[model samples]
Target: MKFSDIIGHEEVRNEFDGLIKIGKISHAHIICGEDGSGKSFIARELAAKILGKTEIKDYADLIEWKINSGKKSISVDQVRSIIEEVNKKPYEGDKKVIIIHDADYITIQGQNALLKTIEEPPRGVFILLLCETMGRLLDTIRSRCQLHKIKKLPKEEMLAFINRKYGVLEDKEIKSILAFSVGVPGKVEDFMENTALKSIRDEVMDTLVSIKNMDYDNIVKCAQKLTEYKELWREVIECFAVYVRDSLIYKETGKEELIINSDKLEDVKKLAMQFSMNRLNRIFDILNFAKSNMESNVSVELTYGTMLFKIQEV
Candidate 1:
């Protein structure tokens, strides 16, 4: 996608263009943000401009235009291979661009191997690095590259983007999805693409309601079923968090805009009634904690079971 096509981050695009115009483009740039926050998109946009490929569709041609191009994960060999490409004269234009998506995944050895090239890249060699966590990068690498922090898009902007691209969604439903998106347009788009996410959302709400009513056996059964798809639990936790958060907002504002579960408000209301605000707040914290633990390689079954038992208490 071109910089103009990105839905949010106008200022960032402007600043990036300014750097390019002023001939102050750093040899390497680090674009940092949470997952699905458009880090990789921005990298490719810059790469396209540097490489003189104007049309978004032309990005696919990169694979054939060069000896080799297209998306490739960061690896030690990949980093080493870039040196050979950069050393050559630019073929398409004055600039040769290389994008290392998920740069945080680059091994320390890869970063060290890349140090010399980044320190003094060949003429017109632009390196773009996309990562969810800046802390994962080496300090030497961080010091050498320009850093850009991409925050979540505003809720209204995200909603408009989803609506503009996907056609009509109920205003209320769009707003709910926007709330759940948490400022990440990519994640927002993912929700649109994955129809199963909706079903999982419904099931999570059902399971939460079951918990509030002290349906112990049912909650256990639901948790067991959830353990079957370990990858989904993170999504489920985020969806559930947004679902309850919006209910609290609805309770305060009495506006449809304040609710994220327009299609399932009855279940939301039921659970909101059964738990105190203090307890709901704790549940949100626990959900976030559980998500963190799950990512840290904690046993999914034990993690989810403990989470379920606590939800049942509520």
Candidate 2:
């Protein structure tokens, strides 16, 4: 994908081009943005330009040499391999590109291995580093590179992207997905692909409704049903997040257009009336923790049971 194809971040795109146009492109650049704001996409796009592969191919194709900087650290082994690749010289383009995704995942050793090269980069070698937070990066690494920041797309552009990709969804569906997706396009795609996400969303609302009416047993049943599938538990957490977010928007703007759980706005309104902000925040925190733990192989039963008990307290 080229800069023109990136859906948003006009300013950043222009900055990127200007650097290339002047033939003074930085050897190392740190591209930082929130999750799903397309940091990796932009990195690959820049690499394509450097490698003289401008045509857009399948997303999967661009990931041919992709390496995961495992767990919170980019291995020194990966850094050495990248250095070896660059030493082969530019094959067909003006520059050779090394695009390192998740720069924050690079360990101190990896960063140290990279420092001398970054400080005195070879002619025709361009490095693009992508991260969510520059603060997490070593200052020595940050000092050698230029930083480009991208923001989440505005709602209109985000919705337009969804429409362009998936056509016009039902208004309620659009609101619900957009609100909960936190303006992340990848998450929006995931929401669209999973047909069961909607039903699971309704179940989350139902659980909230049960909480509203003091139907304690239904809350337990809701948790039990969610544990039936790992994916279902994730959906419950996602929808629940959107549900609370919609409540915040409802309390602030009173606009239905911004409500994520549009079909269950009334239920949200009722619960919003009943729950304190602190209560909502606490539940969201717990669910987020559960998601993190689940990713690390926490048992489904344990995750759901803990979540239900916490929600019961609320």
Candidate 3:
């Protein structure tokens, strides 16, 4: 994809284009952003432009590296191979571009292996590192690269893009999708394509509403059901958090417009009555803790079980 094809980040696009026009390309660049925020897309497009090719596949000088499926980290051997490759002259283009997708997956050893190349690359060599967050990378590695932080599209921009691409969706449906997207277009597109995701979201909301009343056996069953969709646990947790937060807001302001789950206004209002402000705050904290723990390699079933029990107590 070309830079023009990217929906947002106009300022960043302009800056890159200006840099290219001025012939002052940096040897190393770190493109950091949330997943589904177009970090990889932008990096590839920039690499293509740097290689003077209209398409990525047509650019013989472009070397792409990504973490293999089911792999926790990109190994040091992979970085070493790229180091060897970069030492050679470009085969078909004036510039050689290396795009490392999910750069955060590069282990400490891998990062150290890449350090010398990044520090003193050959002429016409450019390295683009795409990562979800910069904190995972070594500070020394980060210091050697020009950092570009990409953010998600604003609500209006995202809605416009969704409308243009998906045609007409119900207003409520659009709002629901936006709520789930958390400002990420890739996420919005995923919600659009995966019909089952919406159903699962609804199921999560229903289960959460009834969780406090469930017996121990039923709670275990509920956790088991959640575990079956472990791949979507993050989204489920975020959606549930938003629902609880909106209920609390509605309780305070009595403003239906302020609630994201507008279709479930009555239910939210009833649930709001059941939770005092402090109780709702604690539940929100529990959901956020669950998300953090899940990212730290905690067991999904155990995390969900604990979260559910804490919600029941709240």
Candidate 4:
């Protein structure tokens, strides 16, 4: 895809374009961003420009390395394979683009194995490391590559994107997806295409809207129903977080334009009135506890039940 096709990050696009135009592009670069923030997509677009191709797919000179199926991290052997391949001349052109996806998952041993190649690659070889975080990378590796971080796109940019791509969807659905996406383009696709995820989003929104008024029996029943959507617990939690955050934002700013759940302006306004700042903060604490518990393999049913009760208490 063209850089112009990207949703945002005008500054980064301009800088990279300028660097490429002047033939001063770095041999190795690190593109860091949140997970599913399209770091690799941006890198691929840049690579396409560098190689004078409209796309990199099926291109002989473009190589990609990622954690394979059943693999937890990039192994040293996998890193070595790319290292050896970088020594070869480009297949079609003078330049080669090697993209390593999920580079944050590269084991310390794997990073060490690939350091030499990344530090001093053969002529015309460029490495693009796409990662969610750079904490796992060594200082040596970090210093060697030019780093470009991807930030959340502007609300306008994000709105324009979903409007153009998903114009057929209802306004409320679009807004809900937009709120959940939080300016991350890659995630928009996931929510749009997954019916179950959309259902879970609806359930979460419904729960948040009704929780305060829910009787004890209803609260327990609601929590139990959520257990059936076990695999989508993260999405459920994020939906809660985003909705509550929107309520908090509305309460403080009293501006619908500033809230992510703009389509739910009336509901959000009501939500904001029901909870004080202290109550909202306590709700956040409950969310954090629920998230931590889920990650720790705690009982999902128990976790949801407790979270619902705690939220009611506040």
Candidate 5:
């Protein structure tokens, strides 16, 4: 994809284009961002431009590395192999490009093995590292690369992009997706393609409503059901958090337009009446904790159980 095809980050696109035009590209670069925030896409686009190819995979000079299936970390052997390949002359293009997807997955040993190559590659070698965050990488490795952070698009830009790419959606539907997507196009696309996501969102709302009066057995069942969606726990918690925030907004202002979940006005109204502002804030905190814990590989059932119990208490 061309730079213009990217939805947002115009400044970043322009900077990369300018660098390419000046022929002053760096030897090693890190493209860091949240998952689904378009780091990989931008890396591929920049690589294609650098190699003068329409597609990155079609360019013979490109060497890509990622964590192998069922593998937790990228082994040192993998990094060494890329180092060996980059030491050779380019096959087709003037510069050989190495892309390491999920660079955070590279173990300390692996990063050490690749450190020299990144610091002083062959004359015509360039490397791109894509990662969710720089915290997992070594300071030495990070210090060697020029870092660029990718951020989510603005609300208006993201809305326009979804409308242009997909068919027009209702304003409320668009807002609903945007609220959960946090302006990430990949997330918006996934919510659009997977009808089940909407269903799960509805289930989250239902569970929230039920938690107000649920007995211990029912609470256990609800937590168990949520565990079944462990892979989507992040999105689920985000959706619930938004719902709680919207409920508070509606309660404080009595303005339906001010809330994100406009389509769920009735539910919002019911929840606003049932919950005080302080309680809503507490519930939001609980949901946020669950989301954070999920990132740390916490037990899904226990996390949900704790959140449900805390919300019930609130």
Candidate 6:
């Protein structure tokens, strides 16, 4: 994609532009950010600008290295082959651009193998490593690269983005999306493309609203049901956090504008009226606890069950 198409992070773009214009290009570069924060897009945007291409596609001088299909991690063999290719002169452009996707998934051996190239590549060579987590890379490797980060967009930017691209959507839907995406531009599109993600959101909201009156048997069933979405517990908890947070906000201020779940205003109001302020705060604590436990590798069922039980108790 074109750099103009990208929103936010103008400073990083400007710095990169200056680097290219002055021919002070760093040999190794790291583009790091969270998932759906557009790290990959930014890397390609830079690559396109460097390669003088309007679109992101394979170019003779642009080498794309990603994990192979069905592969768990990038192998040393792949790294060696790419290194060999880079040693050769660029076939098209004056400089060679190597874009490594999912750089964090490179095996330890692969990283070590690629270390020397990153430290001292041939003249006119530039390497872009795109990673979701910088900790996965060796300190020596990270220390050698010029790091560029794609940060989350601010609320105003995100809102303007939605208005520009999805202006036809109702205000309630826009507000829900604004709240759900939480200032991540790429996540707004991800939620639209993944219909099942929204399904999980609806299920979470419904289960949460019903949890207060559920009998012990029903609570267990609900927890069991939640465990079925093994890979999506985080999304489920995020939905819970958003809805509950909005409910608490609305209850305290009686200001609809202050809350994000405007589409679910009736339900939010219902929740506020049903629970005390103390209970609402307790539920937030429970959600945070469950999220921490899940991230720590706790059993999913136990976390979900405990969260529901504590929320019910409060």
Name the candidate that leads on TM-score: 3
TM-score-better candidate, 1 vs 2: 1
Backbone clash pairs for candidate 3 read: none
**Whose TM-score is higher: candidate 1's or candidate 3's?**
3
Higher-ranked by TM-score: 3 or 4: 3
Sliding window of 10 residues with minimal summed lDDT for model 3:
51-60
lDDT score of residue 108 within candidate 1:
89
All candidates: TM-score: 0.82, 0.81, 0.89, 0.88, 0.87, 0.82
Q: Give the alpha carbon lDDT tens digit for every residue of 138-215 in model 2.
A: 999999999999788888889888988888678877877776566778778877887677667777777765765556
Where is model 4 poorest over a 10-residue stretch in terms of lDDT? 1-10
Query: Which 10 successive residues of model 1 have the least lDDT summed?
Result: 59-68
- Model 6, residue pairs in steric clash: none
Clashes per candidate, residues 3 or more apart or on different chains: 0, 2, 0, 0, 0, 0
Candidate numbers, best TM-score first, in rank order: 3, 4, 5, 1, 6, 2
Q: At residue 281, what lDDT does model 3 achieve?
A: 90
Best by lDDT: 4
lDDT of 4 by residue, 1-314 (tens): 44557677878878888999899999999999987786777888888887878753457888888898999899999888889888989988899989999888888999999899998899999999998889888998999999999998877888888877877778777777887789888778888888887777678878877888999999889899899888889888888888899889988888788888776778788779889978988899999999999979999999999999999889
Question: Which model, 3 or 6, shows the larger TM-score?
Answer: 3
Model 1 CA deviation exceeding 4 Å by range: 1-3, 57-73, 172-176, 247-256, 262-270
**RMSD to native, candidate 5:** 2.7
Per-residue lDDT of model 1, residues 73-145, tens digit only: 4667777676676677766666777776677877788889888888898777787777889888999999999
In terms of lDDT, model 6 sits at 0.84
Over 1-314, each residue of candidate 5 has an lDDT whose tens digit, in order, gives 55567778877778888999998888899999888888877888888888887654457787788898999889999888888888989988678888999999998999999999999999988999999889999999999999999988988888878887887888778867886677788888888888868877888888877778999999989889878887888778878888898899998999987876666778888889889999998888888888888888889999999889989998
Cα lDDT tens digits, model 3, 1-314, are 44556678877777787898798879999999988887777888788878776754446788888887888889999888889988889998678998888898899999999999999999999999999989899999999999999998888889877987898999888877887787788888889888767877777778767876899988888888888878988777977887898889998998987876776677788779888899999998999999999999899999999989889988
Q: Select the stronger candidate by TM-score from 1 and 6.
A: 1
**Candidate 1 overall lDDT versus native:** 0.74
